[model samples]
Target: MTDTPTTLVTATGDSAGKTAITVALARLAADQDSSVGYMKPKGTRLQSNVGKTLDQDPMLAREVLGLDAEMHQMEPVVYSPTFVEGAIRGTEDSEALRNRIREEYDDIAADHDQVFVEGGGSWTTGGVVDLTDVDVAELLNANVVLVAEYGSPNDLDDVLAAADAFGDRLAGVVFNKVSDDAFESLDQDGIPFLESKGVTVFGALPYEKELAGVTVGELADELGAELLTDASTDAFVERFLVGAMGGDEALRYFRRARDAAVITGGDRADVQTAALD
Candidate 1:
């Protein structure tokens, strides 16, 4: 086991902003003059680059942190469809993959003061290959910082479950994308409740539209919609409003939103014009 401290930032569920938290923590460490390194041992979001399959999150981390390590060292296992199928068919060598992840982690740990390992969509992800977030944390002897999106007070149950799953290795839990109303309640009530249960609450981050929004390009890709205009696709859309109301009401609704997208039919010229306006 490496003496260097490592953190595994995982989420309670899908779209819980694990990557965001990991990146934020890495940036904070870097700002404090600490040599920070990042990794995603079992990557599910795969992208092809230079004839090699790579994980997108690690690539973003590598660029953001200005890390000198190569992509292979940052993401040792690309959990693509083929890789999963191999695991299912017993064609993939699980031990070999685990070894590769450890070797890569050691390589990164050797050069940095701290290493941040981002997990997959959820805590239980990668069970087929025996490399769930908890599994990796145990493999690297890492402290786990589980990120969760706050929906209600009941979400604390999930945190407790994670604490049980991670046991003493759980460093803390962070509530992300919390709404304005939920923020005060979580800060006052939720934090104390979890702390009473011996679970540390790192923070309850209020929801920020800019941070939660999806890029227009990503939205288009997910919806399979072709762009008809030359609008900048990089722009983010935090909310989606249907243009079923009158033009004036639609305009009023649009004005209230920070970064939003309007969904309407082509024949509704009034709504379309209002949206454009």
Candidate 2:
């Protein structure tokens, strides 16, 4: 194992694909025969499995990448409503939490040539108890890769803010879910503009519905519903169009979705059949 080489993957907002990017990087590094480790230092989404409550992403890392680490170590801090209240009241121990994260990270790093650290949410999501992405990055001494979604000029402000926040530790920014129409201008003008502002552009990936999606079967599992019709669990749903209109209008809206899932009341046979048709 090398000397705890690590990169912290963070994003601008929700659905920015931070976890997916971390997984891809870890898989690529492992393919190149690098001993790779993965960790999500803090998680907001909790899942109760086999009598243990653990965060989702770190469990994903353990299962998908075959990483050998305890789930608690992979996800040291879980944010519950009570935890947030404690943080707000200044009743939580920030130093102890930081020490726990550092000790877990050091253990993971000791066994791997490189480690990929996944941040919780946006840059400021965990600031209540000093567990923000920047805080964790500074604690771990890891470089930062900021993932951003392209929608408007305001996104540029977020990227610049991240660059200013990380400063020299900022490795680069990867634009996610960019529209095809915007791709040309972003690739041609947007990249150069960011570079001129002293922020390196790794690459802008065109928006693919599949990359930012969850399968219908997965949704059913979460909602505890049984599937009556056979649907491909691997299919990625890029959008969700509610069937609220008449058949003609509904069909028109349905056509607009690429790899989308339609949701309607079970009693609405018209909507269901229209979506099927």
Q: How close to the true structure is residue 275 of candidate 2, measured as C-alpha lDDT?
A: 90
- Quote each prediction's TM-score: 0.77, 0.78
Q: Please give the CA lDDT of all the candidate structures.
A: 0.88, 0.85
The candidate scoring highest on lDDT is: 1
Q: Which candidate has the highest TM-score of all?
A: 2
Query: Which residue pairs does candidate 2 place in steric collision?
Result: none
Tens-digit lDDT string for candidate 2 (226-255):
888785677777678888888888888887
Error of 2 at 258 (Å): 11
| 1-277 per-residue lDDT for model 1 (tens digits) | 5889999999899878888889999999999999999999877777742235877888889888898898888888888877777789999887998899999999999989999999987999889989899999999989999999777899888888888999999999998889998888888888898999999888878887767779999999999999999978999887789999999999888888778898899889999999889
- For the record, the alpha-carbon RMSD of candidate 2 to the native fold, in angstroms, is 5.7
